[model samples]
Target chain A: MLSLFATDFIENSLMKFIQTSGLMAIFSEGGYKYVIMICISLLLLYLAIKHKFEPLLLLPIAFGMLLTNLPGANMFHAELFAGGHVHWDIFVGKAGLIDYLYLGVKLGIYPCLIFVGVGAMTDFGPLIANPKSFLLGAAAQLGIFLTFIGAIALGFTPAEAASIGIIGGADGPTSIFLTSKLAPDLLGPIAIAAYSYMALVPVIQPPIMRALTTKKERMIKMSQLRQVSKTEKIIFPLVITIIISLLLPDAAPLIGCLMLGNLMKECGVVDRLSKTVQNELMNIVVIFLGISVGATATAASFLNPRTLGILALGIIAFGCGTAGGVLLAKFMNLFLKDGKKINPLIGSAGVSAVPMAARVSQTVGQKDNPSNFLLMHAMGPNVAGVVGSAVAAGILLCMLG
Target chain B: MTLFVIDYPLPWSNILLIALFGIAIVFVVLVVLVYIMRLFGYVFTRKHKVTNTKAPLAISEEEVVAIVTALRLYNSALHDKESDMLTINRITRMYSPWNSKIHGLTQMPEHHNK
Candidate 1:
């Protein structure tokens, strides 16, 4: 009787342990997809920490991917997201903690909020001093259009193609904003591709920039940018907001928040508010945005063939955008005088990756001529690229969404 | 006529056309912005130049010297003569979380005590 009781107790304990184990779900439920996704997440984490690839967002995103993919964790419920439509009631009541935070992304709030912080931090002086850089900024968006065509060729929807193409703009927030609205289903792949390519700007842009430009072009020195007055700085954001809003209302939210932040910064009385927006608000939103965006990279969505296509197209978009900017500069040089010739390398800074692309231009230019300081000159196109990409996103939203 | 208007089912012709149109719009808008910025620069700089060229007040050198001396004496009398730089000791205090501008929506907490 004692022997029989002991056997029964052991059997019961073993069955309970097997039933409750996460490892068991890996085999029985998620199967191979779970293993593959876990490996991908680990790879992303390695890239984020070991390689220091945009770790601010990448680390959270990678961890979120890991958390959601762990079999039987029930952290992210796909049923809550139905056919590009979020069932808020289900998400709120049935889903895990991460799902609630993800609502900001689903509703396209986080990216716009991030733009507000970006605008507050950005100085429009460089752009205002040399307004012609706006052309380079516009020219850099060529990759977005080119990639849109490529995505379509690969059988993606117009909406999906538009989202993918915006990755070329190299602005992470703009990419997320457009993707959330146009092709929410492809948000994870598109956002990751956008950010990953943005982090890779220092690597990807230099080779193209060097190949396209002759030694003379790289060594060409630009004139000093003029100092912009406070009045012009204050007026810039307000005027831009009104003009862009009138032309493309779809861009208004992103542009409007950005301008509002800039206005607060330039208005001179709201230093405290501007500082808060730049630091605290930006940090908090980035944390939430990173984790939530990462959580969306499920095996079902991320492992698809479409994602592979997007990753491929993203690099092409970035490369083409760089080329377009450089080529435009060369084209403009034809019209310029001997002393007024613009450095073709400055044009590569026009892809909206901000200071990174601009810094890369400076680095490459300095390699050819150590005395050359292209930082400020490159900043003109660099900042203009932000406005250009926002405008491009607005146009895409107007056309496709 | 609208060339290759975007609609559901996303035809390649429409997608290509949209891309062209999109690029056109980006260029046109930026061109407009560039011109506007140039206009602003012209107006502001021209105004600045005009202001710079305006005649100065006709104060004699003696009067200017007198004014400068008086101002310097006044500053010396009121300010610290020993230290070139002003020293400030900030009060260290613990406050509620609401003191953070990030937390409080109404107003930022004052740095110095009233």
Candidate 2:
């Protein structure tokens, strides 16, 4: 009995044989990763339904997460793909039936296509109407840079730190684009953190906004916006495209595609193309992008010590962004004398989750005054956050890549 | 990164240098963009203010007094407006949840006041 406690395993031939067998080998290698990924999926589901955060994204993301994490989950992995790439194509009659279609993300197609759809849906009128909103947008990104430094200080390489930092964008498409370019291995955890925190924005941002501003400031009424003319609306995206492309040529393709889509949408004459981009094209890309991204959550690639670090840093990035925007708005308010004050809640909308950040802004503002309506006003900074994050992404690509 | 993963290397120092460089770059760019934007906003804002202040006095005192009189008339009507007991008795016959004493007590004031 004493010998059994510390004996060499080979001496127990039957137990040793089982350990070496196919079924047990597969189970031992993959079981823990599957379990942990499943737990994370369940947590996302709980947040989506119970807390009702970014439910549309969380629900699909959680479902895709469940699809990819299960051992031998053929939901994504197929005959064509292995590791993370597609190799030789079958030229013969009897071809491989299975296909691991990782091309959606690996080729870097879905994220850019998603950006086009986002551009089509976005209204740049707010940013153009009040260019100062760009400051809040820029301030919102302090978290990403701060987190990059923190990740590097904690021993992640610069590329790894950059990939991790992009999650703070609160823009999943940008995060995916940067991660695909910078650190493909970290895609799964980085994406999971980005989308998860975006869903938690309602929870995370309100507290930050509350902590930073007083009830009086929250209740401050903003003046009404002048109705943006159709001609100005049509011109805005073109001007932005030129400005951004001239500054960072690396961002040209993305900014160009996005602004082109927006141009089609705003141009009064192209209803057919706009409808297709907004509806059919957008839906197909979102579904493919969601599941394919989910497919990257295989246990072996996802479960690492660094994953824990990425998760912890992600929250820091999000919180810092919120603080930066609020603080910047307060700083600007120094000169705008009299009763006028920039509602600090609008600062959180600068993180670029668009309507989610806007809704969070509106919700926080409502807490101070039931009559205060900030939804439309907050949208200016919200859209600016998208542009700001893209510019920041371009800057990183230039400096690091 | 490759050096640290393989042979012994001072990866920490490299990372520190990269981080500081990134911070300085991002800070300088953001600060300048912010400053220029504020300056432009201020200049345009001052011009807009002068233009706005110069607008005609078209919204005269008579309009204010007329709007106030109309609001007073509506307020008096709403203050006296109420449903009869017969209308309340008819609703009680249609719904059973309205029979709950706790819920009924809370809602009674709103319906009566209205």
- Listed in order, the DockQ scores are 0.29, 0.12
Query: How many angstroms is residue A131 displaced in model 2 relative to the true structure, after the best TM-score fit?
Result: 1.0
Across A247-307, the per-residue lDDT of candidate 1 in tens digits comes to 8898899889889889989999999999999999999999999888888888898887788
lDDT of 2 by residue, A1-401 (tens): 77775575556777877766544645785566677788888887898889886665666667777776665434654334444355556413322211233466767787788788888888876765666677788888878888988887666767778889878878898888888777777777888899889888888899899999988888888877545556667876786688678777766666777888889888979888888888898888877766666666666666767788899999998998888888888888887876566887898898988789999999989988999898987898898788778777777777776
Question: Per-residue CA lDDT of candidate 2, range B11-101, in tens?
Answer: 6666556556654554455455456544544655677778777653656678878989999998877866577665434443555675767
Share of native interface contacts recovered by each model: 0.71, 0.17
Candidate 2 C-alpha error for residue A400, in Å: 1.6
Those runs of model 1 whose alpha carbons end farther than 4 Å from true positions after fitting are A1-17, B1-8, B55-114
lDDT against true structure, model 2: 0.75
Candidate no. 2 TM-score: 0.73
User: TM-scores, in order shown?
Assistant: 0.86, 0.73
